[model samples]
Target: MTIPALEQIHRHASVRHYTPEPVSDDLLERIVRAAQAASTSSNLQSWSVVAVRNEATRQHLAELCGGQRHVAAAPLFLAFCADRARLDRACQLAGLSQDASTLESFLVSALDAVIAAQNAALAAESLGLGICYIGGIRNRPLEVIDLLKLPAKVFPIVGMTIGWPARPLRQRPRLPLHSVLHHETYHPIRDEDLLAYDQTMRATGIYKDPEKGWLARSAQRVQNPERPHLAEAIRQQGFALK
Candidate 1:
């Protein structure tokens, strides 16, 4: 029986281990088409996705993602790029001035790419395929642009790994509703709510580390040396997020 949509969404966990079964081109095409069908900013559709299937390319991308083996082992790897070059070219070809230089336009394309990538990720999960986002893809943005042959005004926002999951998984727990949800006005979260959430997460058994609390894990991530220098990396990749 198919699981409920809300349950599936809330139960999602980043799957790192995958089976040997390969994802077929036809299935991958459908996922891409579904991703394109997602809503876009002013219908500019300023995003591009590259599916990396070759072992060598995947290995290189895996290294870019801090040597995450799943990026190299997954049957399908997708790099989602925020692209303004197409619209700029179209404007120039039509003898019109392109307004793609603004920070707003850059943000729009970045948001659009993220939305499209999530659409594809959810669709793949719904089909029993496991997927994980490779945020480390941004660690070396200029190198990724060179590896992918991306044009000017195009930036790789993130990468994804997709394939059949190899093992039974535990669902990642989330913060309590009160911690995230608010009434019409944004209500400031209370200290009690934060403590309650930490306790709830501790009980979930999803996070195996002995940290025992959400705050500790979050703090560790913030202090992690492996985290990329995101702003400078994006700037180097031609995104002037001014």
Candidate 2:
């Protein structure tokens, strides 16, 4: 109760279901402005945000995102993109070659887009809104590109669903700081420590089955080498991350 930011930081949860109330244009502007204020590499600011309020577009996006109804149901949806098309065009107009389409450049733009989206999510939470990130956006990236009419050199990094929280919910637990952080030197990972952390996670009751621990679930997810078709999408979108 003492630290004001604690409520904003510690209580962050991904809200899947939402009410029918719509987000206002003024509120959306404030969130976007907050996102724009985030730092960018070399001030390139190679990022763009697409606010999808159209029901038709949202329906298509929902289908593209593995049929997650929230994509269309949320009061507002945002597609954060790593954009180099406009920048490349600008450089060309200035009689300069676009060396900015390199792998490093692409990474920087992607990072900028993620940072901006997170900023916007935090700002929305501060305004008493709830949000959930949609990594499923990348599952059918080419479909997203076609649906949104994104040009070459622009990639949809991620999508976000924003709306009022339906009701109060328990916060999701995170791994302990010691497990993830280090001091002066990196500490060796101990099998016992990892098992203990897994036990703690299982005890948190957030997992559907309390018997299933983090290690088993994570290993299963990684064991399948075949992820969603991203390479083809990326290639079709004109990003040769080769």
> What's the TM-score of each model vs. the native?
0.91, 0.92
Cα lDDT tens digits for candidate 2, 125-209? 8888899999888988888998898999889999999998887856766777786789999987778878888898888787998
State the lDDT of candidate 1 residue by residue for 136-218, as single tens digits: 88888878888999988888988999999998866766777877888798988898878888888888876788475887888
Work out how many backbone clashes candidate 2 has.
0
Superposed model 2: Cα runs more than 4 Å off: 1-3, 226-228
lDDT value, residue 189 of candidate 1: 84
Q: Which candidate is the best by TM-score?
A: 2
Report how far residue 120 has shifted in candidate 1, in Å.
0.4
Q: Lowest summed-lDDT stretch of 10 residues in model 1?
A: 224-233
lDDT of 2 at 153: 82
Q: Candidate 2: give the clashing pairs.
A: none
Backbone atom clashes (below 3 Å) for every candidate:
0, 0
Q: What's the lDDT for all of these models?
A: 0.86, 0.87
